[model samples]
Target: MELVVYLAGQIHDDWREQLKQLAEQKGLPLVFKGPQEDHDRSDEIGEAIKGTQPSSIYRDHTASEFNNLRTRIWMNKADVVIAQFGEKYRQWNSAMDASIALATGKPLILIRPESLVHPLKELAQRAQCVVETPEQALEALAYVFE
Candidate 1:
């Protein structure tokens, strides 16, 4: 069966592409959804579309609400939620995605380096499995289907 998977968090890297390629290579039928890929565009889209707000906070709030709308809708539709955390950025959105997945009864796979384990223990406890690489995430996805 085809899977609707939500790929969340860490927009700076190419992890989503990597995961999608892995899925294709392994013959997994997955439809991936997530926030916008371009970090700058994601940040600026609100301003661009809505016109520049009087203050930065207002602009950001507007943008965040729009983003949350898209995310929440996709999250509800997802069969599995895979959130990846990278070393550089503080990915608050990733944590939120995981929590929503758990609350909504969708399986979750969290990907992050070992260095993050200690800080993310609570989040880890919520996941179906926590893995350190894209390959491991792919394996987790396969296991989910099985």
Candidate 2:
């Protein structure tokens, strides 16, 4: 059977595509899913489709809610969740996604550098697998989807 995998967080990088490619190369029966990857488009879709908001906060709120619709659905349907934390930014969304994955009993694999291990200790503890690279995350996927 084909497994649905949620590619969450750190959309700034190409990690999602990389992991999908790896899965394809391995002949794994997997389908990669995620919120919209286009940052500008994801942000603007709310205002574009539903009309503009009054202020920055309202605009962001609208956008967040719009994105959350897709995210929530995917999280529920996902057999596995790989949440990536990038080095430059505070990836709070990733942390949230990981928590949701655990709460929903979806197998979670977190990708973040060694530097974050201490700060994200609690979150890491709850995950099924934690790795530093997308390739390593792919390894976890291979094992699960194989």
Candidate 3:
């Protein structure tokens, strides 16, 4: 099944790589959003995704570009959004993520570590599901896609 995963850019780069790998392994199409990168990593990640699954949307567009306006456009097309919730960082696109997901009423899978503190618990409760691990996120995505 196809899944659109919206990750916060402020998280570690390795986490993005891991989620991408997991998606590829599951034969699930992934849509990634976050930090800017050079040509090589971009090509590699794209190739990895293409190798195993149906074509997916990779939004290189900045969350700021959406700024509630653009996201409303794309959110309608996305089936699911996997986001890092309750994180505060200068680069974090929490507002864009929450607004778009909430607006679309798409199934939102929010991922947060057990140790992390979050103010979005109620929001997550309102979401399709709240996950504590990548595995949980994947499971939630599966449910959403189903």
Best by lDDT: 1
Superior candidate under TM-score, 2 versus 3: 2
- What overall lDDT goes with each candidate model? 0.89, 0.88, 0.58
After superposition, which runs of candidate 1 have C-alpha atoms over 4 Å from their true positions? none
Model 1 vs. true fold: TM: 0.93
What is every candidate's alpha-carbon RMSD to the true fold? 1.3, 1.1, 10.1
The runs of at least 3 residues in candidate 2 whose Cα sits more than 4 Å from the true structure, single-residue gaps closed, are none
- Give per-residue lDDT, candidate 2, residue 56: 83
Tell me, by TM-score, which candidate is best.
2
Per-residue alpha-carbon lDDT of candidate 3 for residues 1-146, written as tens digits (9 for 90 to 100)? 45555564345346667877887788766776543334344434444544433333433332223344434555666666767643445435654575567777767777766645355656666677777776778766655556
Which pairs clash in the backbone of model 3? none
For residues 1-146, write the lDDT of model 2, one tens digit per residue: 88898998887878888888888899988899987999999989789877978988888889998898889999999988989998988797898888889988998988989999899899898898899999998888777654
Order of candidate numbers by TM-score, starting with the best = 2, 1, 3
Candidate 2 residue 143 C-alpha distance from true site, Å:
1.7
Question: Which residue runs does candidate 3 get wrong by more than 4 Å?
Answer: 9-11, 31-73, 86-92, 143-146
TM-score for candidate 2, please give it. Answer: 0.95
Candidate 1: what lDDT? 0.89
Considering summed lDDT, which 10 consecutive residues are worst modelled in model 2? 137-146
